[model samples]
Target: MIQNKGEMTVEEVRLNEGHAFLKGKLQADLLYVGEEDGRIYSLSANLPMEETLNLDGIVNGDKMCLKWEIEDLSIHIIHSRKMNIKAVVTFFASVDELTGVRLPVSLDDETVSVQKKTMRVLSLVIHKKDTMRLKEEITLVSNKPNIAELLWYTTEVRGLDLRPEENSVKAKGELFIFALYTGDDESGTLQWIEHSIPFNGEVECSGCISEMIPNLEAAVINQTLEVKPDADGEERKLQADVVLELDMKLYQEEDHEVIMDVYTPFRQCMPKGRKEILESLLVRNFSRCRIADRIEVKETQGKILQICHSQGKIKIDKIQIVKDGILAEGIVRLKVLYIVENDEMPFYSMEAMLPFSHVVEAKGITENSVYYLHTELEQLSTTMVDSNDIEIRATIGLNVLVIQCSEEMILEKIEEIPLDQEKIRNMPGITVYIMKPGDTLWNIAKKFYTTVDEIIQMNNLDGDEVSSGTPLLLVKKVEE
Candidate 1:
């Protein structure tokens, strides 16, 4: 019942190496119109953006996601006449960013080595001919009879979906529009009107590999809307021209394995231990949360007639990883529009902040895991239940990705093995030994001052296992 013990040496080894970059032009077409003007003219555009990452590959390494930036944007007037106008918006984006490392196998392979020195890069060049086009006209909702001047507008893209296609990738999402303008009622009194419009569109990325997973990230960088009165219309009509710039990035996830440690217990050595940092993905999950609340509209503003529009934003304040789940806390910023009792200024606006707490079910989450969370306001609605109270209901989408980075001490190899001459010389030349259960070749060889190979050669052993009461021939190694 002697326990075999040995000291060992270890070294760190990197298994795979690669680099990441964008291989093509990231393009999106946004076709929209002003709500107030029947005829439109482009004023100015600016693109403000936020960076995002998405994982779109198989569980194994070799799937690619896209990381991109908008370098240049342009808007062209395709058709400009009367109250109706059409324009084409183009996004010239660069996809040259790398996300976190992707490792395929967790900790199963022993001999496999992966060292990712540089990430892999995929490039896409989107020409005008390859660009996807979106066309939609927004109807104006206003109590005023005539449109005066379109002031400004803002747009947001939400509920984005990236799907892998045959030699391409498809991006699908919704657009939320907010427009403000001055208008005249029947009495010719100047008043302000705010309107919201929702639209949907899809874009296809050509020349993409079928195996490539498109991780799509989009943001509205710049938007411009202008209103111009059309003299030809019998009724008081205006032309509205709208322009927007959107930026997108796509990324693919890569996975592989590397050898962490190696050891042999039969030899006596002063093994040096070394520490190495290993990185791997823990979990990726998507969940939907519903939030319900009430807000009071002051009576001085006016009696609530109808809920016209609602928009919301979610900010993640804190995230904690606990056993079997994740705890998330955040605040929801809401803005609602309602019609008033007066016809002169029929629309009234109100803002409210709602705090929320939610627990997402994620198995295998631990305190040592690192995570990234993205929250989106998917859908929002507000209803005027009474003259003083407004009912608000919203759906938020949360996407989380977790990664684990841990340090491990590995055993490389044996450095030295000191032999005992006296013990070797006293060993028997030939002996008939009865094997018992739980007997191993290494243990028996060590007891006889011989090596496992020598015993195997002497007794013509087929395998390392031995049965109880089985006779074994032991011949000690003779000193030359």
Candidate 2:
């Protein structure tokens, strides 16, 4: 095979005790030159895959968030028409469980005191993994040659902008289609065409609103290009089918009061707490990296006569949190198709692996930070440096999301018991208390076996706040 590309699609996920089962399929497109005709050709195949992952703290009802990519691929040709293909696929997964933290909404006993505080939380509203398909048919103009046989094709989706509305989302983007085919002329020469197809679509999403914060990830997963006949009975029409896989997460800001601490004149209450990490959106950055390199044509590979089409794939190797930014190190695998100075084989393809390193600005990022990074080939071009060398220029777009994580103690429930009779009885009915540095109205009231409202009314205070060393009057409630 001359070159290849691949994508992984996850179909099902089943969670059990501390493990997850995944079923998926891998699609690989292989490009090769014909043994007898010396002409280029393309073939596609799907391989079913199953994997078992050891996921800690996973349960049956927990939601599994999974994503996968083809990390590496290798093909070995056993014969002219037979080959062995092996792919290393990488999967990233996380588990999300919905649980309720129950704080006492209202205590039936009036003597049970509660200290409540309103917390602003960034809650996950919706997590959706969906797909959208785009289809287009185009006819070649008079200037372009009619297709005799389709050899190879590549497609990219770019500038996809999404807008959320009431229960739906609108997406607009352009699909870049590149194809190399043999012409139907007398000489049967090879020809290439590049076209941009604009597309707009809407997806129905339940509980989606414009005000919600959206984090979207999209990729061109599957595609097909077919040659067909035009109205004039010429093979000049091209049909393109593309599938875009989208992963969307929407968040909303909400405020709610949860009991932080509690006490009472009649009982003692203890709050059961669990530690959890709260993720807040820090920054969403779309940046570009420009790559320029020269590739020297070896003597074995024929000299380039004219450049036709160029395409690229980005593979990120590592990501590190550096000072004031994130450092991404990766390689851009570029394929360039050109007409060679040869009579038998007029067209040839060359491949190159160009290494690149870029830093995306993400201030305050650390080792504990969570992030999502995606890269796409925005543009690529080739210029002849000399008879034996070619210059490659490319622009790679980087989409990144840095999430700020914070640990919080969530109160789940409260346990109550009878209060110490000795402690309650020894307290005076009324006393003048001095507010300390860390004192609050609720804290003092709980200490003196009273309520925040009663303390404020008795002290004639404007609000619940008091300065250190300020004297406050406290009164204990007596039984009726």
Candidate 3:
């Protein structure tokens, strides 16, 4: 009788072969310009002006955050005898290469197999052309401030959008610029002035494929900014030049046959079996979640006033994978700039560090599974209610990817009992035996304790053929 050993677990081996790279460019123009007096202050400054100019650039430094390559970046100020202010920006980009599995695998009732691989898909950048470019002209009429110095200026990317087209990728997003300067107010007292502007635009990526989608975990790799005063402008007018580089990675999920466990139940005596097993890494889940929360300002921070701007940063501290879900622990750091009810300074900056813990739904999570968690701030908004408190709203995005290492095994062979010799020797010698239909020499020899060669020689009569009811001579092997 054939016995079935229930099932055994085992793993298959696979290797990462190579990668494929996608290259493209991102180009746009700045929309915001400052004008003072009869002179026009544009991005390209030509005239001689006495002022201190400051510039800053912001980018992501995490190596494992995403895979991308920046080939070149350039920012130039465009000057026209008629136009007020204009800037040209360009970015050369290349994404990390992705490779799919190419090896062959086999599956059957006795064996189970699975394949692990990585795939890279392009993420197109998208943004509103009008909303991205923010331009405004402000004059401190009360202060009647003279253009003495440009203190500091910085640029950052808040969000990005990508979409696939027929043969190219569509990119859109906004760049946020903040500038701080020292100036004199109406009373001739020295004060700090803050100004913010946003530039938006959309471009079609020529070398990108249309089937790719925005990655759940895309990130900005590097960025550069240029700020200069227009020489011809009489008043303190400033122009900004900006450039940005982005990186995106693609991921794919596949299902494979894996052995859970194994057992066998037919043999009277326990059969000895051998097992074969392997270890492999597998991705269980890849998804993103948005987290929204509020923060309140304390009374000690002074009375309610106007809020200038708010920024949020998220850092992950720990991650735990449990049954059917995953738990994440992190802290949200918030920085706010606002005016106090009776403060001597025009604006006060306050920073708040908040601890947060959240759970994401993921099925089939076990203790043996490993995980990677990445978080980013998507949006931040604040409202002032009274002199003592302000309400803040923040939107955070979380990316979770799970991996599992599994083992599989299969029964190579089984052990069985030996044949009984005494019963075979007890058969009568020279006895007349009736031939049976559907009989073979080997089966007959096994039944009579004789070898197939002995049975063939003894029953010769022609070949090893016997008809039903035919008489045959049977002999039990005598010892020696």
Structural similarity to truth (TM-score) of each candidate: 0.54, 0.83, 0.45
Our model 1 lands, by Cα RMSD against the true structure, at 16.2
Model 3: lDDT of residue 89: 24
Where model 2 places Cα greater than 4 Å from the true spot, the runs are 6-68, 75-86, 91-96, 103-113, 265-285, 299-302, 322-325, 361-369, 385-388, 402-409, 412-421, 424-431, 476-480
Better of 2 and 3 by lDDT: 2
Model 3 reaches what TM-score against the true structure?
Answer: 0.45
Best by TM-score: 2
Candidate 2 — what's its lDDT?
A: 0.81
Clashing pairs in 2: none
Q: Number of clashing pairs, model 2? A: 0
TM-score of 1: 0.54
Q: Rate the local accuracy (lDDT) of all candidates.
A: 0.52, 0.81, 0.44
The model with the greatest lDDT is 2
Q: Tens-digit lDDT track for model 2 on 107-217?
A: 566666767767666677888878889999978878877898887788888768777789987789888898878888898876788889999987878999999877777
Sorted on lDDT, best first, the list reads 2, 1, 3
**1 versus 3: better lDDT goes to:** 1
Rank ordering of all candidates by TM-score, starting from the highest: 2, 1, 3
lDDT minimum window of 10 residues, candidate 1: 1-10
Clash count of each predicted structure: 54, 0, 30
